[model samples]
Target chain A: EAGVVQSPRYKIIEKKQPVAFWCNPISGHNTLYWYRQNLGQGPELLIRYENEEAVDDSQLPKDRFSAERLKGVDSTLKIQPAELGDSAVYLCASSSWDGYSGANVLTFGAGSRLTVL
Target chain B: AQTVTQSQPEMSVQEAETVTLSCTYDTSESDYYLFWYKQPPSRQMILVIRQEAYKQQNATENRFSVNFQKAAKSFSLKISDSQLGDAAMYFCALGEYGNKLVFGAGTILRVKS
Candidate 1:
Protein backbone atom coordinates (compact mmCIF):
# COMPACT_ATOMS: atom_id res chain seq x y z
CA GLU A 1 0.00 0.00 0.00
CA ALA A 2 1.32 3.42 -0.89
CA GLY A 3 1.39 6.18 1.68
CA VAL A 4 0.16 9.71 1.17
CA VAL A 5 2.17 11.46 -1.56
CA GLN A 6 2.99 15.16 -1.92
CA SER A 7 4.90 17.02 -4.60
CA PRO A 8 7.60 19.69 -4.62
CA ARG A 9 9.21 18.47 -1.42
CA TYR A 10 10.72 21.96 -1.20
CA LYS A 11 9.61 25.34 -2.49
CA ILE A 12 11.13 28.79 -2.38
CA ILE A 13 9.23 31.90 -3.34
CA GLU A 14 9.20 35.60 -2.61
CA LYS A 15 6.60 37.34 -0.55
CA LYS A 16 3.42 38.21 -2.46
CA GLN A 17 4.04 35.35 -4.86
CA PRO A 18 1.49 32.61 -5.30
CA VAL A 19 2.33 29.05 -4.25
CA ALA A 20 0.42 25.83 -4.42
CA PHE A 21 0.95 22.39 -2.89
CA TRP A 22 -0.50 19.09 -4.08
CA CYS A 23 -1.44 15.92 -2.27
CA ASN A 24 -2.56 12.42 -3.27
CA PRO A 25 -3.93 10.31 -0.50
CA ILE A 26 -3.87 6.55 -0.08
CA SER A 27 -6.24 4.41 -2.09
CA GLY A 28 -9.57 3.52 -0.49
CA HIS A 29 -9.32 6.33 2.03
CA ASN A 30 -12.38 8.52 2.22
CA THR A 31 -11.13 11.37 4.37
CA LEU A 32 -8.32 13.74 3.35
CA TYR A 33 -6.79 16.68 5.16
CA TRP A 34 -4.42 19.56 4.52
CA TYR A 35 -2.33 20.97 7.35
CA ARG A 36 0.31 23.63 7.82
CA GLN A 37 3.31 23.35 10.10
CA ASN A 38 5.36 26.37 11.07
CA LEU A 39 8.92 26.11 12.22
CA GLY A 40 9.26 23.85 15.26
CA GLN A 41 5.54 23.38 15.49
CA GLY A 42 3.00 20.64 15.00
CA PRO A 43 0.72 20.41 11.99
CA GLU A 44 -2.50 22.42 12.10
CA LEU A 45 -5.51 21.48 9.99
CA LEU A 46 -6.25 24.00 7.30
CA ILE A 47 -8.96 21.94 5.69
CA ARG A 48 -10.48 18.47 5.72
CA TYR A 49 -12.36 16.68 2.96
CA GLU A 50 -14.66 13.72 3.24
CA ASN A 51 -14.86 12.39 -0.31
CA GLU A 52 -14.40 15.64 -2.26
CA GLU A 53 -16.63 17.74 -0.01
CA ALA A 54 -14.87 19.94 2.51
CA VAL A 55 -16.41 19.21 5.88
CA ASP A 56 -14.11 21.39 7.98
CA ASP A 57 -12.17 24.44 6.85
CA SER A 58 -12.73 27.10 9.45
CA GLN A 59 -9.04 27.35 10.15
CA LEU A 60 -8.08 28.21 6.63
CA PRO A 61 -7.18 31.79 5.86
CA LYS A 62 -9.84 32.48 3.30
CA ASP A 63 -8.29 35.79 2.36
CA ARG A 64 -5.36 34.14 0.61
CA PHE A 65 -5.50 30.43 1.28
CA SER A 66 -7.77 28.18 -0.74
CA ALA A 67 -8.01 24.40 -1.06
CA GLU A 68 -9.82 21.91 -3.22
CA ARG A 69 -10.11 18.15 -3.23
CA LEU A 70 -11.56 17.08 -6.55
CA LYS A 71 -13.18 13.64 -6.79
CA GLY A 72 -12.02 12.95 -3.23
CA VAL A 73 -8.90 11.19 -4.45
CA ASP A 74 -6.44 14.08 -4.35
CA SER A 75 -6.18 17.56 -2.90
CA THR A 76 -4.48 20.88 -3.54
CA LEU A 77 -3.81 23.85 -1.26
CA LYS A 78 -3.01 27.29 -2.57
CA ILE A 79 -1.74 30.45 -0.97
CA GLN A 80 -2.14 33.52 -3.15
CA PRO A 81 0.12 36.52 -2.66
CA ALA A 82 1.93 34.56 -0.01
CA GLU A 83 3.37 36.31 3.02
CA LEU A 84 6.38 35.61 5.12
CA GLY A 85 4.06 34.16 7.71
CA ASP A 86 3.02 31.58 5.15
CA SER A 87 6.49 30.10 5.13
CA ALA A 88 5.85 26.64 6.48
CA VAL A 89 5.45 23.03 5.57
CA TYR A 90 2.21 22.01 3.94
CA LEU A 91 1.25 18.49 4.97
CA CYS A 92 -1.42 16.18 3.60
CA ALA A 93 -2.99 13.35 5.53
CA SER A 94 -5.68 10.74 4.97
CA SER A 95 -7.75 8.23 6.92
CA SER A 96 -10.53 5.75 6.43
CA TRP A 97 -13.78 7.15 7.78
CA ASP A 98 -15.74 4.18 9.07
CA GLY A 99 -18.78 5.93 10.45
CA TYR A 100 -19.08 6.38 14.21
CA SER A 101 -16.72 3.54 14.96
CA GLY A 102 -13.91 5.11 13.01
CA ALA A 103 -10.56 5.51 14.76
CA ASN A 104 -9.80 8.59 12.66
CA VAL A 105 -6.17 7.61 12.58
CA LEU A 106 -4.34 9.78 10.07
CA THR A 107 -1.53 8.82 7.72
CA PHE A 108 0.59 11.74 6.59
CA GLY A 109 2.69 12.64 3.57
CA ALA A 110 6.19 14.05 3.50
CA GLY A 111 5.16 17.69 3.53
CA SER A 112 6.01 20.39 0.98
CA ARG A 113 8.26 22.93 2.60
CA LEU A 114 7.51 26.47 1.53
CA THR A 115 10.11 29.14 2.13
CA VAL A 116 8.99 32.68 1.54
CA LEU A 117 11.76 35.19 1.27
CA ALA B 1 -13.82 22.04 19.69
CA GLN B 2 -10.64 20.57 21.15
CA THR B 3 -7.26 21.91 22.10
CA VAL B 4 -4.11 19.92 22.79
CA THR B 5 -1.10 21.17 24.72
CA GLN B 6 2.44 19.93 25.03
CA SER B 7 4.08 22.13 27.65
CA GLN B 8 7.51 20.64 27.20
CA PRO B 9 9.28 22.38 24.40
CA GLU B 10 12.12 19.89 24.43
CA MET B 11 13.27 16.77 26.27
CA SER B 12 16.46 14.75 26.32
CA VAL B 13 17.09 11.12 27.15
CA GLN B 14 20.02 8.82 26.76
CA GLU B 15 19.78 5.87 24.47
CA ALA B 16 18.58 2.70 26.20
CA GLU B 17 16.89 4.87 28.84
CA THR B 18 13.30 5.81 29.50
CA VAL B 19 11.59 9.13 29.03
CA THR B 20 8.14 10.55 29.45
CA LEU B 21 6.53 13.35 27.44
CA SER B 22 3.59 15.17 28.92
CA CYS B 23 0.45 16.35 27.17
CA THR B 24 -2.92 17.74 28.16
CA TYR B 25 -6.05 18.43 26.18
CA ASP B 26 -9.42 20.14 26.60
CA THR B 27 -12.61 18.89 25.03
CA SER B 28 -16.25 18.90 26.00
CA GLU B 29 -17.06 15.78 24.03
CA SER B 30 -17.16 12.54 25.99
CA ASP B 31 -16.33 10.27 23.13
CA TYR B 32 -13.00 11.12 21.57
CA TYR B 33 -9.52 9.73 20.92
CA LEU B 34 -6.01 10.85 21.81
CA PHE B 35 -2.92 10.30 19.72
CA TRP B 36 0.83 10.77 19.78
CA TYR B 37 2.59 11.36 16.48
CA LYS B 38 6.28 11.49 15.71
CA GLN B 39 7.78 13.72 13.03
CA PRO B 40 11.42 13.35 12.26
CA PRO B 41 13.42 15.58 9.94
CA SER B 42 11.67 13.78 7.10
CA ARG B 43 8.55 15.87 7.94
CA GLN B 44 5.97 13.08 7.78
CA MET B 45 3.74 12.56 10.78
CA ILE B 46 3.81 8.97 12.06
CA LEU B 47 1.32 7.63 14.54
CA VAL B 48 3.16 6.58 17.67
CA ILE B 49 0.22 5.40 19.78
CA ARG B 50 -3.39 6.22 20.45
CA GLN B 51 -5.92 5.85 23.26
CA GLU B 52 -9.68 5.75 23.16
CA ALA B 53 -11.27 8.02 25.72
CA TYR B 54 -13.72 5.39 26.91
CA LYS B 55 -11.07 2.76 27.46
CA GLN B 56 -9.68 2.52 30.91
CA GLN B 57 -6.59 0.60 29.91
CA ASN B 58 -3.94 2.76 28.35
CA ALA B 59 -2.68 2.12 24.84
CA THR B 60 0.72 0.57 24.26
CA GLU B 61 2.78 -0.16 21.16
CA ASN B 62 6.21 -1.72 21.28
CA ARG B 63 8.38 0.49 23.50
CA PHE B 64 5.79 3.27 23.58
CA SER B 65 2.93 3.49 26.07
CA VAL B 66 0.50 6.17 27.15
CA ASN B 67 -0.69 7.05 30.62
CA PHE B 68 -4.19 8.28 30.10
CA GLN B 69 -5.80 10.32 32.89
CA LYS B 70 -9.32 10.99 31.83
CA ALA B 71 -10.22 13.02 34.86
CA ALA B 72 -7.23 15.26 34.47
CA LYS B 73 -7.33 15.30 30.71
CA SER B 74 -3.70 14.30 30.65
CA PHE B 75 -2.11 11.84 28.25
CA SER B 76 1.58 11.31 28.74
CA LEU B 77 3.76 9.10 26.59
CA LYS B 78 6.46 6.87 28.07
CA ILE B 79 9.14 5.59 25.78
CA SER B 80 11.20 2.79 27.28
CA ASP B 81 14.62 1.72 26.08
CA SER B 82 14.79 4.71 23.82
CA GLN B 83 16.85 4.57 20.69
CA LEU B 84 18.51 7.17 18.52
CA GLY B 85 15.70 6.78 16.04
CA ASP B 86 13.37 8.17 18.67
CA ALA B 87 14.70 11.65 18.15
CA ALA B 88 11.88 13.68 16.67
CA MET B 89 9.18 16.22 17.30
CA TYR B 90 6.30 14.58 19.15
CA PHE B 91 2.80 15.92 18.79
CA CYS B 92 -0.29 15.23 20.87
CA ALA B 93 -3.63 15.23 19.14
CA LEU B 94 -7.32 14.92 20.00
CA GLY B 95 -10.04 13.78 17.64
CA GLU B 96 -13.74 13.05 17.72
CA TYR B 97 -15.49 10.89 15.21
CA GLY B 98 -16.14 12.73 11.97
CA ASN B 99 -14.30 15.78 13.32
CA LYS B 100 -10.95 17.29 12.62
CA LEU B 101 -7.96 16.24 14.70
CA VAL B 102 -6.56 19.05 16.87
CA PHE B 103 -2.83 19.08 17.42
CA GLY B 104 -0.41 20.47 19.98
CA ALA B 105 2.61 22.59 19.25
CA GLY B 106 4.79 19.51 19.76
CA THR B 107 7.75 18.61 21.96
CA ILE B 108 11.17 17.93 20.53
CA LEU B 109 12.81 14.80 21.92
CA ARG B 110 16.55 14.31 21.67
CA VAL B 111 18.04 10.88 22.17
CA LYS B 112 21.66 10.92 23.28
CA SER B 113 23.77 7.89 22.59
Candidate 2:
Protein backbone atom coordinates (compact mmCIF):
# COMPACT_ATOMS: atom_id res chain seq x y z
CA GLU A 1 0.00 0.00 0.00
CA ALA A 2 1.16 3.50 -0.75
CA GLY A 3 1.99 5.75 2.18
CA VAL A 4 1.43 9.46 2.58
CA VAL A 5 3.30 11.30 -0.19
CA GLN A 6 4.90 14.75 -0.12
CA SER A 7 6.66 16.69 -2.82
CA PRO A 8 9.82 18.78 -2.92
CA ARG A 9 11.71 16.75 -0.36
CA TYR A 10 14.13 19.66 0.05
CA LYS A 11 13.65 23.37 -0.52
CA ILE A 12 15.87 26.39 -0.07
CA ILE A 13 14.57 29.92 -0.34
CA GLU A 14 15.62 33.38 0.61
CA LYS A 15 13.93 35.30 3.38
CA LYS A 16 10.74 37.21 2.48
CA GLN A 17 10.10 34.75 -0.36
CA PRO A 18 6.93 32.77 -0.71
CA VAL A 19 7.04 28.99 -0.28
CA ALA A 20 4.54 26.18 -0.44
CA PHE A 21 4.49 22.50 0.53
CA TRP A 22 2.20 19.81 -0.83
CA CYS A 23 0.99 16.58 0.69
CA ASN A 24 -1.00 13.61 -0.62
CA PRO A 25 -2.38 11.53 2.19
CA ILE A 26 -3.04 7.80 2.16
CA SER A 27 -6.22 6.65 0.50
CA GLY A 28 -9.31 6.37 2.69
CA HIS A 29 -7.73 8.31 5.52
CA ASN A 30 -10.04 10.94 6.95
CA THR A 31 -7.64 12.84 9.15
CA LEU A 32 -4.69 14.85 7.81
CA TYR A 33 -2.24 16.88 9.84
CA TRP A 34 0.64 19.26 9.15
CA TYR A 35 3.54 19.57 11.55
CA ARG A 36 6.74 21.58 11.69
CA GLN A 37 9.91 20.20 13.22
CA ASN A 38 12.93 22.27 14.07
CA LEU A 39 16.40 20.81 14.31
CA GLY A 40 16.77 18.54 17.36
CA GLN A 41 13.09 18.94 18.23
CA GLY A 42 9.98 16.88 17.82
CA PRO A 43 7.21 17.89 15.45
CA GLU A 44 4.72 20.59 16.44
CA LEU A 45 1.25 20.55 15.03
CA LEU A 46 0.37 23.44 12.75
CA ILE A 47 -3.03 22.36 11.55
CA ARG A 48 -5.34 19.38 11.26
CA TYR A 49 -8.08 18.63 8.74
CA GLU A 50 -10.94 16.24 8.87
CA ASN A 51 -12.04 15.69 5.28
CA GLU A 52 -12.63 19.11 3.72
CA GLU A 53 -12.95 20.95 7.00
CA ALA A 54 -10.13 22.16 9.19
CA VAL A 55 -11.02 21.14 12.70
CA ASP A 56 -7.92 22.35 14.50
CA ASP A 57 -5.69 25.17 13.31
CA SER A 58 -5.10 27.25 16.39
CA GLN A 59 -1.35 26.76 16.14
CA LEU A 60 -1.17 28.05 12.58
CA PRO A 61 0.26 31.52 12.10
CA LYS A 62 -2.50 33.32 10.30
CA ASP A 63 -0.38 36.34 9.42
CA ARG A 64 1.85 34.42 7.03
CA PHE A 65 0.99 30.73 7.05
CA SER A 66 -2.10 29.27 5.36
CA ALA A 67 -3.27 25.74 4.56
CA GLU A 68 -6.07 24.15 2.58
CA ARG A 69 -7.41 20.69 1.87
CA LEU A 70 -9.86 21.33 -0.94
CA LYS A 71 -10.66 17.83 -2.09
CA GLY A 72 -10.10 16.26 1.31
CA VAL A 73 -7.33 14.12 -0.14
CA ASP A 74 -4.47 16.47 -1.02
CA SER A 75 -3.32 19.44 1.04
CA THR A 76 -1.09 22.45 0.58
CA LEU A 77 0.59 24.64 3.19
CA LYS A 78 1.89 28.01 2.19
CA ILE A 79 4.07 30.57 3.85
CA GLN A 80 4.02 34.04 2.39
CA PRO A 81 7.12 36.19 2.82
CA ALA A 82 8.86 33.46 4.73
CA GLU A 83 11.28 34.39 7.46
CA LEU A 84 14.60 32.91 8.56
CA GLY A 85 12.94 31.25 11.50
CA ASP A 86 10.67 29.36 9.12
CA SER A 87 13.39 26.89 8.31
CA ALA A 88 12.26 23.47 9.38
CA VAL A 89 10.91 20.13 8.13
CA TYR A 90 7.23 20.19 7.17
CA LEU A 91 5.76 16.81 7.93
CA CYS A 92 2.38 15.49 6.78
CA ALA A 93 0.57 12.67 8.47
CA SER A 94 -2.76 10.88 8.06
CA SER A 95 -4.78 8.70 10.34
CA SER A 96 -8.12 6.89 10.55
CA TRP A 97 -9.99 5.32 13.37
CA ASP A 98 -10.76 1.62 13.27
CA GLY A 99 -14.39 1.10 14.09
CA TYR A 100 -13.79 -2.01 16.14
CA SER A 101 -10.41 -1.35 17.75
CA GLY A 102 -10.90 2.44 18.10
CA ALA A 103 -7.21 2.87 17.38
CA ASN A 104 -6.02 5.76 15.26
CA VAL A 105 -2.52 5.31 13.90
CA LEU A 106 -0.78 8.12 12.08
CA THR A 107 1.16 7.40 8.90
CA PHE A 108 3.75 10.00 8.01
CA GLY A 109 5.30 11.11 4.78
CA ALA A 110 8.97 11.71 3.96
CA GLY A 111 8.47 15.44 4.77
CA SER A 112 9.55 18.60 2.99
CA ARG A 113 12.68 20.27 4.29
CA LEU A 114 12.48 24.04 3.98
CA THR A 115 15.59 26.11 4.55
CA VAL A 116 14.99 29.81 4.64
CA LEU A 117 18.04 31.95 4.25
CA ALA B 1 -2.04 21.51 28.78
CA GLN B 2 0.05 18.43 27.97
CA THR B 3 3.83 18.25 27.81
CA VAL B 4 6.32 15.47 27.20
CA THR B 5 9.88 15.50 28.45
CA GLN B 6 12.98 13.57 27.45
CA SER B 7 15.70 14.25 29.97
CA GLN B 8 18.51 12.53 28.05
CA PRO B 9 19.43 14.48 24.98
CA GLU B 10 21.68 11.69 23.74
CA MET B 11 22.51 8.10 24.64
CA SER B 12 24.69 5.33 23.25
CA VAL B 13 24.53 1.57 23.45
CA GLN B 14 27.05 -1.03 22.33
CA GLU B 15 25.89 -3.45 19.70
CA ALA B 16 24.06 -6.48 21.07
CA GLU B 17 23.45 -4.62 24.32
CA THR B 18 20.35 -3.19 25.87
CA VAL B 19 19.50 0.48 26.26
CA THR B 20 16.59 2.36 27.77
CA LEU B 21 15.28 5.78 26.77
CA SER B 22 13.25 7.54 29.43
CA CYS B 23 10.25 9.80 28.91
CA THR B 24 7.79 11.55 31.23
CA TYR B 25 4.60 13.39 30.42
CA ASP B 26 2.23 15.71 32.28
CA THR B 27 -1.40 15.51 31.38
CA SER B 28 -4.68 15.94 33.20
CA GLU B 29 -6.48 13.45 31.05
CA SER B 30 -6.27 9.94 32.41
CA ASP B 31 -7.15 8.16 29.19
CA TYR B 32 -4.70 8.99 26.45
CA TYR B 33 -2.14 7.40 24.18
CA LEU B 34 1.64 7.36 24.21
CA PHE B 35 3.91 6.76 21.25
CA TRP B 36 7.56 6.33 20.38
CA TYR B 37 8.63 7.47 16.95
CA LYS B 38 12.00 6.95 15.28
CA GLN B 39 13.51 9.31 12.74
CA PRO B 40 16.71 8.33 10.96
CA PRO B 41 18.86 10.23 8.49
CA SER B 42 16.14 9.68 5.92
CA ARG B 43 13.95 11.95 8.03
CA GLN B 44 10.87 9.77 7.95
CA MET B 45 8.74 9.56 11.09
CA ILE B 46 8.35 5.85 11.76
CA LEU B 47 6.11 4.60 14.52
CA VAL B 48 8.16 2.33 16.77
CA ILE B 49 5.54 1.43 19.36
CA ARG B 50 2.45 2.66 21.14
CA GLN B 51 0.89 2.17 24.58
CA GLU B 52 -2.72 2.71 25.46
CA ALA B 53 -3.38 4.35 28.79
CA TYR B 54 -5.94 1.85 29.90
CA LYS B 55 -3.91 -1.21 28.98
CA GLN B 56 -2.24 -2.71 32.01
CA GLN B 57 0.19 -4.84 30.07
CA ASN B 58 3.21 -3.20 28.51
CA ALA B 59 3.62 -3.15 24.76
CA THR B 60 6.33 -5.11 22.94
CA GLU B 61 7.28 -5.26 19.32
CA ASN B 62 10.10 -7.56 18.31
CA ARG B 63 13.24 -6.22 20.00
CA PHE B 64 11.50 -3.00 21.03
CA SER B 65 9.38 -2.77 24.14
CA VAL B 66 7.86 -0.12 26.34
CA ASN B 67 7.61 0.02 30.13
CA PHE B 68 4.53 2.06 30.84
CA GLN B 69 3.99 3.32 34.37
CA LYS B 70 0.56 4.87 34.66
CA ALA B 71 0.82 6.26 38.16
CA ALA B 72 4.29 7.63 37.56
CA LYS B 73 3.34 9.12 34.20
CA SER B 74 6.50 7.60 32.77
CA PHE B 75 6.95 5.66 29.55
CA SER B 76 10.33 4.23 28.66
CA LEU B 77 11.49 2.38 25.59
CA LYS B 78 13.87 -0.60 25.90
CA ILE B 79 15.79 -1.79 22.87
CA SER B 80 17.48 -5.13 23.21
CA ASP B 81 20.42 -6.30 21.10
CA SER B 82 20.68 -2.89 19.61
CA GLN B 83 21.80 -2.65 16.00
CA LEU B 84 23.36 0.10 13.95
CA GLY B 85 20.06 0.61 12.18
CA ASP B 86 18.51 1.62 15.48
CA ALA B 87 20.60 4.79 15.72
CA ALA B 88 18.28 7.72 15.25
CA MET B 89 16.30 10.47 16.95
CA TYR B 90 13.63 8.96 19.16
CA PHE B 91 10.64 11.12 20.07
CA CYS B 92 8.07 10.57 22.77
CA ALA B 93 4.58 11.86 22.09
CA LEU B 94 1.29 12.02 23.99
CA GLY B 95 -2.22 12.38 22.67
CA GLU B 96 -5.62 12.41 24.31
CA TYR B 97 -8.59 10.69 22.82
CA GLY B 98 -9.47 12.56 19.59
CA ASN B 99 -6.93 15.28 20.32
CA LYS B 100 -3.71 16.60 18.86
CA LEU B 101 -0.31 15.20 19.79
CA VAL B 102 2.16 16.75 22.20
CA PHE B 103 5.79 15.80 21.64
CA GLY B 104 9.07 16.09 23.48
CA ALA B 105 12.32 17.56 22.19
CA GLY B 106 13.50 14.05 21.38
CA THR B 107 16.51 11.90 22.35
CA ILE B 108 19.30 10.87 20.00
CA LEU B 109 20.16 7.20 20.16
CA ARG B 110 23.61 6.11 18.99
CA VAL B 111 24.58 2.47 18.55
CA LYS B 112 28.29 1.70 18.74
CA SER B 113 29.68 -1.40 17.12
Scanning candidate 2 chain B in windows of ten residues, the lowest lDDT window is: B94-103
Q: Look at candidate 2 and give me any clashing residue pairs.
A: none
> lDDT: which candidate is best?
2
Q: What do the candidate models score in CA lDDT, each in turn?
A: 0.92, 0.94
Candidate number achieving the greatest TM-score relative to the actual structure: 2
Error of 1 at B108 (Å): 0.8
Model 1 per-residue lDDT tens digits across residues A1-117:
899999989999999999989999999999999989889888888998999999989899999999998887988899998999999889999998646555788999999999999
Worst 10 residues of 1 chain B by lDDT: B39-48
| lDDT for position B65 in model 2 | 99
Worst 10 residues of 2 chain A by lDDT: A97-106
Tell me the interface RMSD of every candidate, in Å: 1.3, 1.2
Cα lDDT of model 1 by residue, B8-103, tens digit: 999999999999999999999999999999998775789999898989999999999999999999999999999999999999999987798999
